[model samples]
Target chain A: MSPEAQEFLHTFVSESFYYWASVFMLLIHAGFLAYEGGASRVKNVLATMVKNLITLASVGLAFFFFGWWVYNAFPLFPMAGPILGPWTNPEASEAIKAAMPYVEGSYPWSSALGPNNADHMTGVFFFAFALFAMTTASIMSGALIERVKIGAYVFLSIILGGFTWLVAAAWGWNYFGWLFAKMGYHDFGCSGILHATAAFFTLGVLLNLGPRVGKYDPQGKPRQIMPHNLPLTMVGLLLIFIGFYAFLAACVIFLPGYEGETTIYGTPVTLASIGVSTTLALAAGLVGAYISAKADPFYTISGGLAGIISAAGGMDIYHPAVVMLIAFVGAFLMPKVAMFVERMGVDDAVGAIAVHGWCGVFGAVVVGVAAGGFPQGEGIPAINLGTQILGVVLFAGLLGFLPGYGCSWVMKRFDLLRVSPEEEVAGLDLADLGVPGYPEYATYEYVNEQLPVAQSSGSTKYAE
Target chain B: MQFSPLLAIFNPSPFQTHSEFLEVEGPFYTFAHQPGMIAFLLILCALGSIYFVYASFFIKGEQAGLKSPLALSLLLALGLGAVAERVYQQTLRQSDRPTSAVTRGVQMRSPQAPSPRLKPLALLGLVGGSAAASRRRRSSASRQRRIR
Candidate 1:
């Protein structure tokens, strides 16, 4: 084939591959919405889905307008400096322009519009990465399900999806990034940078938002928030794991370098190696989480996903046996963490804090032990246990937990966090959407007749 | 564990004792495999597992899915089989066959082009679909409550 043809084929195939992969990833959102909605009682489901649906739309625009740029420029750029300097420069190279969003014209797709190029492939590449930002933001939506104002949470997603994650990705995820080059940190696919960060962010909001009314008894005992629909939540989690494969693959450079052969098995760099690790890790996690639970549907399904995320950073190098062990550990811990949080009076509506935050933290730290070190060699911050802890502390604590909790705390001071007692029992949906989901049957009477009081705290009613 | 006394009689260490059984490879396994099989298997496994979990958990009522499970299992098996074959090919083969061309060609390659935005357009579709989902969920719940 002509060099030109090869280039075209490469560009066409890469672009197409990414485009379709992104479509599969998109299934995760629909699954998340359905699962979260089901986990939520009907009174609040419509509202919950609304929060999830608009998060993508609102956060998408936020990411387009500015989010994608932050990932490219923030690594070395001082935070206090001008945000647009590196990203929006009109003089950027063609390769850079070819990689951005909202370009109507061509070449050097202005930093304003994101880069563009004939030979370069930045637009879709940016999107491939951008998909992660969206997912990370969505992770938080479930935790703050019932009473968070739709507008407030949607706007929060813009910060998480468009700004915060991009900064962290730029700082930690970049190959030549300052943190990577100088600190010796190695997070293959953002166990700390993405999942852990988002999880803590959700916790911050929940802390300020407070637990759902009656989440604790008069004696402050915790109650179980059984899923309104178990099947949906489990399905949602599985879709998340499937989407994770694309998310993982997008981060890896599978193609051979110039003038070298791609190795497999004994030769090394085999695609099968990656596959085996991923599958075994997932299977192990599923088994581990299931065994721990006496047929607990929610935990078992979530365990499978926790399995993958835990192994992700190290999957590139781990043996299949080791990967499974790590996965099981990741999955089994989520429910335990959830129970701990409940005991502490922290109301996490979904297990986001455990599934994403706590497990994400473990995954990052585990890489140091399991891989024995990062693939990148020395001077990188990730090799040391302290640095991994630092990454988690910064991403999950300083950025996510502290800010989230502080902001939520301030919001709570004005009684903005919780709804009225009547509304709490009544639900956030009716208050926010101006529509009651149930019409003819008296709401409480019907709930009382059908479900036990413990199962009947349907706290949002916009669906009516 | 009750068989431990029998096992202790056989060997002092278990980790180093795999020699008790003869070593052999699966018939289909080989080391010349590339990313094509791996990538293919990854796709099949991902989709299949998703289907299995989805049906097992979410699908309810009379419309319980039948085809999905079979389809999923087949996809999963094919993916696993291909991946296993590829792994064996990589590990057992000792040739310096310049495998990059094969693997890269199979799974990925150098930069040439990027596909245009299906996403921006898809976002429009999502917007429309989500609107419909919101309304449908509401009305269905109301209808159920009314019947009750």
Candidate 2:
């Protein structure tokens, strides 16, 4: 093929690959909606589902306006004058500068944001990254279900999805990012950047938001708050498992002239490797959860996600057996972690902190242990253990926890974080949205009767 | 006068002439070059600020003192006004140029190029009009309750 023909083919294939990956990633949102909706009591289901929808819209718009620009502009942030300033690989930095050329391409007003004949990749690539942003926001949403004020949640979502995670990506995930260039950080599957960051962010919000009203007894002992529909939650997890494949696929790059695929770090990898490891990780996770959590359906399904996340950091590097072993151990430890978190007086409704946060950290550590001394890229330092630990602390504590905690703390001070106690007991859908998720059911009538007369005034109309 | 970063945000497009802008190739070429884009963004910022205030305060029934929202809205409006004034000046300058320059600018844009004023105006109408309509509904409902 001619050079031009090869370039065209590459652009077309790359565009189609990301576009399809984005389309399939929609299933992750669908899964989150189903999962959170089923986890909430009947009254809060619509409220739970609406938050997921808002996550998609808010993050999408935010990413379009500024999030993409942040990723492009801040890869070597705090060093303004020369692109090759301190702690950066000059050659790799130059290559990335040529590839991104953010000033010309990434601004909201840039022609690349529109239908420019000169650019074919920006829009689809932006969509894929935006979906990742939405996924991060959705991961936080499940942990705050039932009692969080919608407006407060939306504010936090934009901060996390649009701003914070992008900052983390600019630091750790980019080819010439300071973390990779200076510390040889590698997280091919975004285990630290996306999962751990969002999970830790959720932990911050949960600390301020507190447990649901009835989550604990007067004795301070935790009680079981059964999901409205366990089966629906399980199905949601299954869809998420499917969507995760696309998520992993988006992390790989298909260079135009190169014969094989590469991880985001430009290291050689294969789709077959990703597929085999992911499948085995899922099976191992399920078995581990089954044995550890005593066949609890919720924990078992959750283990599947924990499994992928625990092994995600090394998906491009780890052998199938290693992946399986790591995933199994992560899943086995997830319930214990959740119990530990709960013992510390934090109530995570969906084990999000455990599944995403704990497993994400676990995955990153495993990679450091397993792939230590591996070459990252030209002019970048080799991967090592200390940097991986630093990534966890940076991603989880500085980037994730501080912003999450500070923002929620402010919201809490203003009484904007959680719904009023009255509203929480009356159900968020009835109190806030003024519609029940299941108005046709007799349970609606029962709930209406259960409410005090003052709280029931406007809600009775729903029954009528 | 010292340059204000806030002022820079309102004047996003740097190109001064249609000919100068057309030298750049891409889709949405005209859209980005047009001064109206600045007004559109300023208006978006204004509306977003207003909505955030409304959602955070009014919807939650918290007493938000009028000052914060009022000041923010005023600042955003000033930004929009500046953009509009600049666009008006640019339009006047462009009218003095040769007709061929104008024709070339038009030709450079896609066939579906939107009128420069349409987006900001439409967005203003949608958000402001919806808020007014909802307030009217609430008032009528309260009036009915008093009557009953």
Candidate 3:
């Protein structure tokens, strides 16, 4: 094993981890499909499922191509240099091609692998971000579950997941992003970029699409749209929680490396910090949401997630006690805010507006004050509540909510947003699927065996 | 407006060289732009008061248990916020960060950066379009009732 083989091996393993994370994140999409399917009316389940599947296929492919490139390119393309600047950047581009990693003039993509100087984690790193992009799109899938057309929603998913979320990530989340470099804006994970942006975007779409036909009466009052299967929905959220952990874990650089002072404690970076804060936040969120909800299982689970969303921007540095405490606030706010949004006539079917969108804004904004006066890092500007709010505005309002609203307005104008009224009444699934998933669920044998008994009982009871 | 003033409050600064974007010096540091948990609590208290005062005008008939869907959604929102933040922190999520010590011009690279040509979108449009291309699920009873 030569030293060169070691570097190549590292790149392979890291890239593999990156791709596999997507495999794990896939469970989240699957869970959302099931969860949304269950939440929908019986007539609309399959249609909802199709919406989920479409988001996955479309968002994945979109990100794989230019989606990933844009993230890489935007970080410093014009700022860093020129056309091939991103491609040739000594820092961020492909290390193998530049360095001639293995044999000179003979490599995978080209004759030489780029520069050999980098630690070799860029591809895996981008893949991780791409996965986040997919989740952002997937978030919209859940909110617009019952009404959005598969085609229309799929188109929307590509825009939200592939383009919108990436732009936010570049602006707020990326270290080299102008936002991070200049604004001192910080989002440890996507409080704004992923969650908030998706939430607002969903709100935008819902505004134009309107609720499922009967969601509101002619009187403008909202109705109770129960999940067709509460237990299944619960199960779906549990899967989301489990997979969400992966989504969160993928946001930080976790691979082992040596920073001076050798000892883990002394090293500026440690997975332990993330681990501790995450735990504290989860516990706090769980308790806070559960306490408020009186133990409603659905809210309990979703609140737990919201807690994390609201505090995600600086989870990496908050004290454990503070982390738990803030998480409680996160949990406390998520529901209250969402309910308020709903009351305002903005229907977010799965609370996407509240959980991801509003909460994301809150979380991003929270960072400005939470770490106030602290050095944002050299050359990264000073912290300001106003700036943080602006970041939230840039991401949630401008890039996310406003644009989302604008898109919906346009979509509505073009008649490309949702199904017609008749279809909504019949149920999108029934119109889409040739047959309903359930026919009272009587097995062929059971129906034969039980039908006669039922008939006999009816006759006897009536006769008596 | 200055971006970091507010942002700094929430995600204030830490020590890092121009080169080391990926390093964190300590446990999660609370920022200065916004109130810490204590201030947030005060705000919540204010909000609670407002909520209570608003409800004071409501008749007794309006008070209800946790069964309403709106109530349930509110509850879910809170929980999901916590969970999303927690999940992000707990996972070993990372992006590429060049080391501070590595002299100028030394950074990692990736395999052919993902290309954004028409191919990827075509695939998504094709497969995802199938979702649109899919057969609409129908209910037998509705179909039968219509036929009758």
Candidate 4:
């Protein structure tokens, strides 16, 4: 091919790849919708679906306005001084300069954030990151479903997605992030910055929201709250499994250099490694979860997720055996963690906390041990047990759990954290939306009667 | 590239009593063959096994003593995170090269693009409107029930 043709082709391919990555990330949301809907009771399915849809819309717009800017701008934020400066390379220095959120080249007001003759990839890149931000919000959404107020949900979603998650990305995921530059923090696939952040955020919300009605008996023995449609939930998980291909691919930083694709931290890796580690981890997780939970399908699918998360931090560097073994351990531990949390009275409707939170922390630890002493970035220290552990604790405890807890606590104080008990027993659909997801399958009286405390007598009278 | 763990299964010197497994290829066997990684995996396994056994057999459910320990552990984690972040900031400051936190934050807020403020307003409106409608519906339903 001619030189001009080759350049055009490269641009076309790069833009196309990013666009597709964003599209595939949408599948993650579809999966969450299906996953949450199936997990919800027949009455709350529509409500659950609405929450998922709103998160995409809210987080999408918010990300466009401020989220992307936050990621670029805050890499060395909440700290003083130039990071990795004294740069002789013009390109490198310019790239760093443009990262500031309010800068002319990168932020919302900048033409760079939009489609321009000079740039074709910026918008596409933003789309992918926006989707990631939305995904983090959706993870928290699932755990708080069926009980949370819409106002509270939307408020928290924006805080987590558009603000907190972006901030965490700035601190940890950014190449120039102080965590990477100074502390040698490494999270190849956002296991800590994204998944664990969301997981801990969800955990905090669950603590304040309280358990679903009849989740436990008077004796405190947990009762089973099975998914309304296990098949749908499984299918949703399958969609997520498919979407993960794009999610994992998006983590690669493809630049014009001797090495084409590298991690955000500038670490070179083969796509083959990611593929091998992810699949083996998934397989191991499935087996571990299946065996641990005595072959329950819900836990089995959850195990698959745990598997992916368990090895996510080291996917680029880990051997397949390491991936499998890590995932297996994570999968096995997740169910026990879930049961333990349930006993503690934090009723996570799905195993969101176990699969995302515990597994995320586990995955980062895998990287610390397995890939410890490996260089994470230029001029930074090697990955180590202390750094990895510190990242997990900070992301999961301070950045993740603290904000989630504080937000939900305020919402709870104002009675915005949960639906009224009457709404809970009658179902969110009848109470909130005045419409049932399935009128044919609706059994209002039976649902109300099963409640430990009957707040409403024969849920009746509705407005058009 | 066609990747496989065949080396793990088909070692050339199978007859040797003390053959090194470090020569294997593929993503799985290559890393597992490393001594440090092997030691890491073994330690993790041992710890995992003990924890699993203890959790399953001894700590059944609703133990009152668990709360204090969990709280204490979480507090320690928070303190450690705070310290680490502070240390990281210190390192960034003491370095010969410096990154400007103030300029970055300022530049981040003042994008060169024509970013309209209407989008955020619209988002707030959508969420606020839906919430109000739901609140009205619930109050109206309750009133209707009371009248009946």
Q: What ordering of candidates by TM-score runs from best to worst?
A: 4, 2, 3, 1
Can you write out model 4's per-residue Cα lDDT over A218-330, one digit (the tens) per residue? 99877878789989999999888878878888887774223356678876666667777778877778866765664667888888888998888878777565676678867
lDDT of 4: 0.71
What are the per-model DockQ values?
Answer: 0.02, 0.01, 0.15, 0.04
Superposed Cα deviation of residue A7, candidate 2 (Å): 3.6
Instruction: Flag the better candidate by DockQ, 1 or 4.
Output: 4
lDDT of 3 by residue, A292-387 (tens): 444555566777777777777767565554565557666755665665666677777777776777668877777665654344555566545556
TM for every model, in the order presented, reads 0.66, 0.71, 0.68, 0.73
Chain A TM-score compared with the true chain A, each model in order: 0.84, 0.93, 0.82, 0.91
lDDT of 2 by residue, B2-86 (tens): 1111111122222333233323333111124444554454455445435444543434321111112343345447645854664
- After superposition, which runs of candidate 2 have C-alpha atoms over 4 Å from their true positions? A1-6, A79-100, A444-464, B1-148
Per-residue lDDT for B76-142 in model 1, tens only? 3664474355334433341333334332114221233122122112322432343344346556866
Residue-level lDDT of model 1, residues A1-464, one tens digit each, is 99878867766766676666777778778778877987897677677878888877877787777776677656544522233343365346432343233232212345423544553456676667668888989998998888777666876788788878777776667643455556645576688889888988888888778788768998997787777678878777777777877777666543312221121111113345656777787786775555444346777787777888888765655555456656766775566566667667888887888788877998987665444322242223224444566667778876677766776677678666556667656676676676654445456645565445434566344224
DockQ of 1: 0.02
The better candidate by DockQ, 2 or 4, is 4
Candidate 1: where are CA atoms >4 Å away? A77-120, A254-272, A374-382, A413-418, A435-464, B1-148
Q: Which ten residues in a row have the lowest lDDT in candidate 3 chain B?
A: B129-138
Q: Write the per-residue lDDT of candidate 2 for residues A154-189, one digit (tens) a residue.
A: 999999999898888888898757787777787989
CA error at residue A91 for candidate 1, angstroms = 13
Clashes of each: 38, 1, 116, 14
**lDDT of model 3, residue B66:** 30
Q: What is model 2's DockQ versus the real complex?
A: 0.01
